[model samples]
Target: MSSSLRNRLAAVVMAVAAGLLGCTPASEPGASSEPAKPHRVLNTTAQPEDTIRVRGDHTERLQAFLRLRYGDKAALDAPWKDAWEDTEVEALRPVTRRVCARDTATADGQEQTLLAVCQTLDDAATVEPGRVDLYVLRVGTDEEKTNRGGFFAQLPADDPLLVMAQRLQGQYGRHGSPGTVQIAQLGPQRRAFQISHEEHRRGHRRVWRSYIAEHNHRLRDVARYRDHLDNLALHGCDGNPADCGEGVFAVDFNTTVGDSNAVEGYWPLTVRASGHDCTGPATAFYHLIFDARQRAYPVPDDLQRDGCADS
Candidate 1:
């Protein structure tokens, strides 16, 4: 089936699994007295030089960089101001005038993304072969405009990353386009960068939990629960409408290799699909194998969750 269909299925299935595997309920009754006090600041920023390098001048540095910093802002803002201090010189290969998907329009299921690769500043080049193939940047409308000064570059509709983002956004009922884009090398390792669902969820859950804990009890005690509910309901995903669906989805980064850049890695991608009613949860599963090369590792047999047989 199509990748979008596969992703939706995977998300639904995983969401269910995520709910079952480790979700601590809303902490009703004396269940822990208080839901961990909301933890105030549950920091999710990755440190600079958090490199996960593979073959073909590929490193996770850029993706990690964007995730920890610019994941919430536009390309120009690049919130992780301090990371540059420790980053190696090669990883600083910044590009100019790349378009970024807008923030406000993204909430209605639209997706803003950045797809880039590392190359030498001295020589023009494309993303190194076998480097990460896809990356996404998700943000909110009201969030500050981070692009301090740079021309935005739009992506051709055929571009893989852009196509996928557009499709997914349509599924959720929104529209957007790329903002600014660029790539850098922090030393010898080349890196590709983009925003991801895991990063967004990290931010969303932290904020949601804090808001609920702080006001839920107060509202109930004062018989102002409806007031609180109305106020909260007005604010949607990063300010989108309530029906815009949850601001959570998945992103996959694949790789392609050239003959000259042979490295040890498998290129195996497994996708499963299932459906559910609109009111019920949707579910699917995805398991991929990769070689040391960080490329897709092929598998001999189609693997599925063991023990579930056809009726």
Candidate 2:
């Protein structure tokens, strides 16, 4: 399928999940606070590095881990902060709290192999901004379960992901059940529930699109990646090969965390990862992050470009 179509489909799936689970009405358009200048904030003093493993390939294991944490909704939208070499803090909001796992393990029939060093974030902590404790794991399915036995503890009450999910669920409940959230059906291939999810996902994308369109800006030209480990690999760990360079970074355009009156709300970024050299197109797990952060930071000069076209 085309990239746009795939994104649209992903959105539909997320909306259905939201309606079923009754998530909040997603974040308000101008709810995000102003962009915070790039400052090194400790993730969380309490958070420590840890790891977990799942029984599957890298893709399945990662997807399952994401589903467990973010629910099916996150697959529709990917969230993160954008910054430049000279960014100044105008506003800051915790977009997601991720714990990087190293040397994790996962089962693959007769043998256990290290698939990926997993990073698991409490779905509840993603909403706040700051350094969060992270762990690296040798890939394995039982590692997370085993590690959490005594080490797991409570997180802050206002963690961004926790708060956002709570609020979203409340909204979804208030709106009625997932079955009640409906959208115009497109055809035999598309269902009402699917359409609704797509709409919610698009709600955020529309915000980003509008922001860029209004400002005559485009993602490849205006944004920069935070250079986290996952981001580095996802964006192609310096190789920047043509086939491995497609990526989309979505940000919220508002100022407050949950403010109900922001303008031109969502920000969906589409970056062609191929700029680094000959990397191919990169991909995001979500179609639209039904509820995610919106960052306002500048892009690095060396990374700016027009489209995801071949360099």
Candidate 3:
């Protein structure tokens, strides 16, 4: 029931299969190098004067979009200069040709949203017929600080990978799954498949580099979120109105998104607490994000300190 227990459980449940929960790539056959039209404005932050161009290769589209968002100073990760935002895509099977993103950073620093999109072009592919069209990645953040900190992506709620990881993670927590679960039990959560999806993919430098990056992200996210779980417990209903149940904390996931080529965004968890006899729960957002090197822990919401004194 404690936050520490919950975090340990979550860490055990999730191997941090990050991209697994992120949006996927869709391949095109004989498709032109020109970018496709907007499948739908997944989400945007550009002012009315901004020009959103969704044509050309994914690299060009992302660069153009960033320049539009951050002005001419826009520059991408060094390794990804030749591709879509430093994304490593295999060239066979669901061979990805490009990745792109459109984000907003209003001068006022209002809430911002980053939409990282990907496109795959393959000669022969039927795994997901017609799934090759552009669609927002399932995990993302639309927060102002998240955007300014360069950690936002358009990860949707229903991504298959996200669902799988959450299901595995949900088994954790006091009322959820057991705390002793192992990563291997989660079914080879790594991106590389047991079967050889691409013969030449193993040789690509980008592929291996991306995998290393992904592994690092996983380690960082698990440790960070686990720490969040441990710390949130300290603020439980410590000296609250007696009628409320003891330490009754209810929580739900806000989201997980790809922020940039380097660090991923593990958005805050929407949480609230109250006792059994209490009329309502005190709500707040708890974020435990992992920057390229470290995890930023969650702090108190406005009401956390005043109301839940005992917590």
- The residue-by-residue lDDT of candidate 3 on 1-311, one tens digit each, is 33543565577556455456774445578768886432222122222112232445445555665454334544544211112221223221222322233333321232222332232323333222111111111222245223534222232322111101100011112211111211111012222110001111111100000011123323212331211111122334334433335443322222233333323333233333322221244344444333434443233444233222223
Best TM-score among the predictions, by candidate number = 3
Off by over 4 Å in 2: 1-55, 75-77, 80-129, 141-311
* TM-scores, each model vs. reference: 0.17, 0.18, 0.20
Model 1, position 42: C-alpha lDDT score: 11
Residue 8 error for model 2, in Å? Answer: 33
TM-score-sorted candidate list, best first: 3, 2, 1
Q: List candidate 1 stretches off by more than 4 Å.
A: 1-176, 179-191, 195-285, 291-311
